[model samples]
Target: MSADRPELDRCSRCGECRAVCPVFRETRRETDVARGRLLRYRLARDAGRFSAADREAFSRCLLCGRCLEACKAQVDVPALMQIAKTDSGFAAGWPSLLTEKTLADDGRLDAAVRRYRSLSRWLGRATPDDSGLRLRFALPYLDAGRLYPKPPARGYLEQHTGRRASGVQKLAFFAGCGAGRLLTGVGEAVDRVLAELNLTAAIPEQACCGLAAWGIGATDAARRTAIAWVRSFAGEEYDAILSPCASCTAHLQTRLPQILAGTEFAADAARLAAKVEDFFAWLSRQDLCFDLAGLKVGAHVPCHARREVRDGAAFVSFLKKSGAELVKIDERLDAQCCGMGGSFGVLHPELSRRIGLPKVAALRAAGAAVLVTNCTGCLWQLRDLAARFDPALPVRHPVELLDR
Candidate 1:
C-alpha cells in the first residue's frame, strides 16, 4: 500500500473530479469523491488502520478512472482505491473469496452460470421479446425487475473450442465471461465479422480476465486469474490476442503486466499485453465495408475503453466508416458511465441505477434506433436499462451491426 502513497499524494484537491464522477454527482457526498477518499487514505495510513467509516468511503467508488482523467496532477485514484481496499483487509472478505474460488476457475465459473440458468428457468418469467428473463420475486443479489439475458443452450467456448478458421495472421480469441457465456450472440457476431474478412481466429481456453477481481481490491485473486490467463495464451503462435470485451482487453493490455510485474511470468505477461487488442480497435483498422447506412446507432463507450485502452477515436472512426448515423445525446450524458461498474451494480444497485438513468433517458430522447456498446458489462446494464426504460429500443454489440 505504501507503493501507492506517491500517487495518492499527487491529488491537488482541485475538485475537478466533481465535474465528471457519476457517483459523486448522484450522492453529492464528499466521502464518495476522489479528494475526500484520498484524504481518508492519508489519515488511515498515519493511523495504521482504516476505520469503519473510511472502509465504507473506499467502497463507494466506481473505479471508472474518470477522476484520473480530470486531475491535472494525473493522480491514479483507481489504483489508490484498490490499494486502500487491500490495506483495509476488506478485499479478503466474501466477495473477493467468491471471485477467487469461482471466477478464477473456468470449470466452477461455468457450473455456477449453468446453475443460474436452471434457476432462471424455474422461477423467472420470460420477457415479451424472449430476449431475457425477469424474476417474480427478488433474490439475494438479484432484483425482481432486472432483465437477465437468456442463457444459450451452449456457451461460445463450449461450441467453438476446437473450431478453427484459416487466415494469414495467427490470431487468438479470448471470449470473456459475458460473450462466452451470458451474451453468446456477441461472440457469434465477432465470428461473423471475422468471416467477412476471411480471417479465422483461434479460440483459446480461457477464464475471466480478472478485471472484476482487481476492481474489488482482490489483488491476489486478480493476480492468480491473470497468471492463469497468461498461461492460457503462452506457447501459442498468435500474432495478436483479441477480446470482444473492452474491459478484458484493456486489463490484459495495460494492467495485467503490472499485476505480474515482479512475478516469474512477467515477461510473458508483457509480451501478451503488447499483442492484446480490443475487437473494435482491430476491426476498425481492417478494410471491411459494413452496410449500416442510415441506421441510427447510439454508442456507449465503456469507461475502460475510454480511459485504459484509449480507443474512443478508433470506436468513433469505426462507426463513421460503417455509414451509421451516430445519434447525438446530451453533452453531459455523452461518454458517461452506463453504471455497470462490473460488481458495482451488484453492490450498490440503487446508486448504479441513479447514475445510469440519465444516460438511458438521453439516448431514448435522442431517438436512437438501437444502442451499441462493446463491453459485456455495459451491454448487460444498457440492455436492462433499455428494457425497463424503452423496450422498443434494442441493445446490440458493435460487431453485430457490422456483421449485419
Candidate 2:
C-alpha cells in the first residue's frame, strides 16, 4: 500500500466505523464498512489497479460521513471513496451519465421534469392527501410502488426569477434542484418565512448545486455545474446566500470552493462560499415567535447539518422554542443518514431502503405526529418511507411549520 494517499494510510483499521455504518449493520459485511473500504483502496493502490470488485466496493458507500465523525485518526473516507470511484471509472456508466447530462443543463433538466410531470399525470394515481402520485406501473428508473413529490407546474426559479423583496439587508436564495423543481412548496414556505421576518431575498436563476454529480465521482461535470451556479449569483451583491436544503448549504459552503480551486471562478466561489448560510442556522438567529402549540414534531437531522453546517442543535432548540412537543428517539439515530444520498437512492434502492427503514421505524415507534428534516433529499426519502409506513404521517421541511 502506498503512503502517498495519506487519507487511506491514516486508517488504523479501527472498527468503530463498523458499529456506526448503517449498511454494515444490515449486511454485516466487512467490505461494507469504511475501514474495510479503506483497506481495499490501499491494496488496490498498491497493485496500481482497481478491480471491478474494488469499484463496486467504493460505490457501495452512502457518503454519509459517519465514519469520518467516528474515526479518531480523522481519515476522510468519503473523499477517498470519490477518488477511488474516479480512478476506477465507476461513474462513467449509465446512471452517472444520465445525471451528468440532465443536471448540468438547466433547460434540459427542466424539459425532462416537465415530461415526467406530464407522464405522471397521465399514468400515475393521485394520493388521497394530494402529496404526490403513486405510480401504477414501474418505469425504467421509477418503481411502481414509489411515492414521489409532484413537481410544481412552474418551478421556483421559473416563476420567481429576478423577483426581489424590500428589506434592510440584501439576501439571495439558492433553491437547489429539490426545492426549485420537485417540491416548490418548500421554496414558497421559505419566502413566506423570510417575509414574516421582515427580511428580503432575491430569487436567482440557479442550476443544480453539483453535489449529486460530485457524489457519483463525475468530477468534471460537477466542476462545470459549480462554475455555472457560481456565475448565476456572482453578479449580485448580497449580505448572504441562503439555501433551505442542508446538503446544498453544506456543499456550497464547503465543496464549491474545492471544486473551483485554480479555475477563474475560484475567487468568486470563495466569496459566495463565505456568504453561504443554512436556513436553519439563519432561522435560529431570527427573533420571531412560532406557534406550533400542539404539534408533535420528529426531527431528523441531515448528515451535512451535523458535520458541515453544525446547525442540528440550533434547529432542535428552535423547535423547542416553537412550543412543539419533541418526540424522542434513540440518541444514536440523531445524525444517521436517511439513505437519500442523491444518486445512491437511485442506483442502490434496496440498500438505501435497508438503511432508511430502521431510522423511519424508530420515529414511527416514538409516536411522532409529523416528521421534519432540513435537507430536501431527506425530506423526500422520509416522505417515501413515511408513506409506506403510514400515509397519514406527513413529512415536511422545518420552514413549512413557520409558514403555517
Candidate 3:
C-alpha cells in the first residue's frame, strides 16, 4: 500500500522482471524494466537526484504490473515508480500534457473531438486513400483521415443519464471515458446486457478515469480527474459501481483509494473503491444465461483483468455456462496488454505495434472469428492490430458478444 521510494528497496534485482515487462520485452532497455527502474529510482533517491533525464527513464514504462506479478519480491514497481515521479515533481513531456489538459476538461475534449469528426467526414468524402493522407502529430490522434476511433459529438453521459431498470439488485455504471467517448457502441452494448439480465444500472456522470494521465507523469491532472469522478457518483445509491473498461476498473479499484489516502475525500474514495467492480467480473457473478450454440469465441483477457485475475475464473465459468464453444488462445497472450497503453500507441505507435504483434498472431492462430475482452483500450488496440496484421479478426467485448 506504500508508494514511497523505500518500498522499492525490496527489489533484489533478480532480473525476473525483464522476462515479463512489456516495455523491456520490446526495447530490452534496463531503464524501462521494473527491477532496473526501481534500482534507478532508489539510487536517485539516495543521491538526492531527480533530473529530467532520470525522469524520462522512469516515465518510459508500461506500468503494466507484469513485473509485480513476476517478481518473487512482489514489489509494486508501477506504484512506486509513479509515486516517485510525483514526489520528485517530474512532469510528462509537453505532448502528453497538452493532450491530458484537453481531456481533463469535458467541453474542450468534446470540441476537440468534434473537429476530428469534421475532418474525418471531409476525408471520407474526399477519396479512398484520404484515410492515410498526412499529419502525424498524434494529439487526440487525427492521423490523416483515419481517426483511430470515430468520435461523436456527444459522449455516452451526454446522451444517456440515470437508471435503466428497477430491481432488488442495483449498481452504478461508470461508463468509462474510453468507451463513452471513442467506442460509443461499447457503452450501448453494456446497457443492452444489463437490461437483458434484468439488472438495474444507474448511469453516473464521470470524467476521465485518469489512468491515461496517470500512465504518464501527469499527477495533477490525474488527481483532479479522480476527485471529479468521486464527486460525480458520491450520492448515488447502488450496491456496486461497475466499470466496463478494465483500465477504468483497475484505476477505480486500485489507484483511487491510494490517491485520496489522507485527503478529505478519503472516505468517499474508499467507498467507491469498495463498490468498484470489473463489468465482466460483476456480470459473470450474476445469474444470467446465454446459448452460444455452434460458436467458437475466444477471450483476449486484458492485462488489468490479469493483474486483478481473481475474477478470471468466475468469468470463464460464466462464459462456459453460456453454451459458447470457448477457445482460449494462449495463457501468455491472454495475460498481456494489447499494446495500447492508452496514449502509448499514440506516443510510440511502432513500439506499441511491435508489442502487440504477438498477441495479434496468437489470436489469429486461435481461429476464433470473434475475440472478446473487457478492456476498451485492449479492444481498440486489438482492432487496430488485427486490421494491420490480420484483417479478418473481429474484436469485441464479452457483453457485446453475449448480447448478440
Which residue runs does candidate 2 get wrong by more than 4 Å? 1-4, 95-101, 128-130, 310-313
In candidate 3, which residue pairs clash?
none
RMSD (Å) of each candidate, 1 decimal: 1.9, 2.3, 3.7
Candidate 1 to truth, TM? 0.94
lDDT, candidate 3, 241-309, per-residue tens: 878877788888888888778898889999878888877678776777788777677676677777763
lDDT of each: 0.80, 0.81, 0.70
Residue 313 of model 1 has an lDDT of: 34
Q: Write the per-residue lDDT of candidate 1 for residues 214-233, one digit (tens) a residue.
A: 77777788888998898888
Q: Best lDDT goes to which candidate?
A: 2
TM-scores, one per candidate: 0.94, 0.93, 0.86
Candidate ordering by TM-score (highest first): 1, 2, 3
lDDT for predicted candidate 3 compared with the true structure: 0.70
Model 3 weakest 10-residue run by lDDT: 125-134
What's the TM for model 2? 0.93
